[model samples]
Target chain A: MSTERGLFDLTCADFGLIRGITESWDHLLSRSIAAVREQFIEQCGLIAQAEALPRIAGRILGLMVFDGKDYSFSEIAEELQISRGSVSSSVSLLTAMGVIERTAKPGDRQDYFRLSEDPYTTFFARARNRAERAHKTIQETRDAVPKDKREIRSRLKEYETFYATLIKALDSGT
Target chain B: MSTERGLFDLTCADFGLIRGITESWDHLLSRSIAAVREQFIEQCGLIAQAEALPRIAGRILGLMVFDGKDYSFSEIAEELQISRGSVSSSVSLLTAMGVIERTAKPGDRQDYFRLSEDPYTTFFARARNRAERAHKTIQETRDAVPKDKREIRSRLKEYETFYATLIKALDSGT
Candidate 1:
């Protein structure tokens, strides 16, 4: 009788502590909201949108980040109303970008995906890098063309200089 | 012998007058390449790259100002290497943007386009108006969403703020 009572008492104490921990965790809870962001894990959806990922990727990011738990590929596809192929491609890109991570359940052959701690850092940096690379290629094109060809090359060089100048100016401010 | 002497006398007088004119107009002739004062007219290309129309529209202003010539739609499309459909759209947009104008050629069915002499003033004013219109729409979107769904609304607000801030910064820059 005493052991049964002790177990009951212990269970009740654990439940009470759980409630207290949640009640005192305003900062931690707000991380899931917009306030206490640790490198903006919460804004995964917004970051994904600016990255020009397909709608499938947006839902995948949203579910993985906001759904409070990791999800398997098939499960996410069903949730997002996308095909498994779409889910695979979206998650693959997100995983490669380090925005989403993959894990496997014990004894389960299939892997699951979840959001990373710093989604926006990858989002902005990768996007900037891609644009900068294209900018470089365009500059190369401008240079490879000969001079004095009816001023076409001159115009290309001028535009390339302008873009390089503008992006730098914007970067300096931001 | 008298006829030959008469021809020689006439040639000498013509040469003296030609030398006088050359000496007087030497400065202008020195500045003129090919010894001709060929005017570079800035014509807006009727057809433009659709994907690049907006950015190209701005560059067209620079192109006209720099090259001092009017470019036909086909010429612009060929130079830019974009489809005629795209150039068509861009020229239309630029016309609407009021940065360029269409000129009619007598007996020519196809219209020629050129940069407006007053480009900067109108483009700046129009861009400001566009920013104001965007701000109003953003404000409306914010108001339309429920306050409790702050996460979604706040992200959108941040995007709007970024664009608004960008416009302000650009407008302030020379």
Candidate 2:
């Protein structure tokens, strides 16, 4: 037998993650994978390494991709062992961003939800739309702000222009 | 007058940023900036949008640069309005990474600290050291683990090799 432990083979009993994961009713490694995966997709700029917000957000998104079936609000909250309020808010945000679909399930009063199969495209669409608006606003500021007092606006304009042009080129070429 | 907020004219508020330098300390925008800036410097790879972390870390470092003199733990904490524990930890991490120096002032029991110049070089040294160890560990695992069971190790080896070489080159450079 090897002296080292397999990444997933080790139990919560062997580590604090297991203790927390089990108590939280989650698989720690699985969650870590999800969190890491989210960062790869969004690179939203690093935040506190102490708390993995990406993984927290990822788990919520991953859970929505539940087995071919749409889930209700209560069912999701129960499964994730999280508050209904949290699920509601996260779901609302995801829905507004078009990465999750929400509708009434047969014989259910609560909204039913499912992950968007093309979450990458949908998510990017939402992000791109926001980026475009920001770019426009920044450009507007650049034009209207007095020349002597527009350093920040100039910086914002540079960023918006770079990203806007880059994404457009990507869309056209891809 | 154009309908856009002009330069940093001592008093313009950003939608997400505190407009005036004298904006109320109690405002959410100001608090958000303080928090974001804090996370930014401590954790690298942050972009400008990291309006909080990078900004906070930069400001703290900047403040230390301005003083160019040792500050008691309490003094720095009070200036930033953060708790002593946080100051202690941030300072400790900075010291370990060689970003700051710690010492006891003459005839004073309390330890005082100041930012160490050329923190960029020191920061990369710490990071490069970490990357080397992680790469070596992963390379060892790839060599030992069963072929059918070592896909993660294998992929890690490829990536680690690429990064290790890159970091090594950077270290040897300049």
Per-residue alpha-carbon lDDT of candidate 1 for residues B24-101, written as tens digits (9 for 90 to 100): 666333334322211111112211221223555644554554454677877777766668887788788778867678
List, residue by residue over B1-174, the lDDT tens digit for candidate 2: 656554655433453465344455533333443443343323321321232233334445544643356788888878778777777776776677676788788888888887665444553354356546545544543444345545444444544564465355435522
Against the true structure, what is each candidate's TM-score? Answer: 0.48, 0.38
List the global CA lDDT of all models: 0.55, 0.51
Give lDDT tens digits, candidate 1, residues A14-57. Answer: 88998888866743343244332222322334434433456557
How many clashes in each candidate? 18, 15
Question: Which number leads on lDDT?
Answer: 1
Top DockQ prediction, candidate number: 2
Which stretches of model 2 miss by more than 4 angstroms? A1-58, A65-69, A103-110, A117-174, B1-59, B65-86, B97-112, B117-174
Interface Cα root-mean-square deviation for all models = 10.9, 12.9
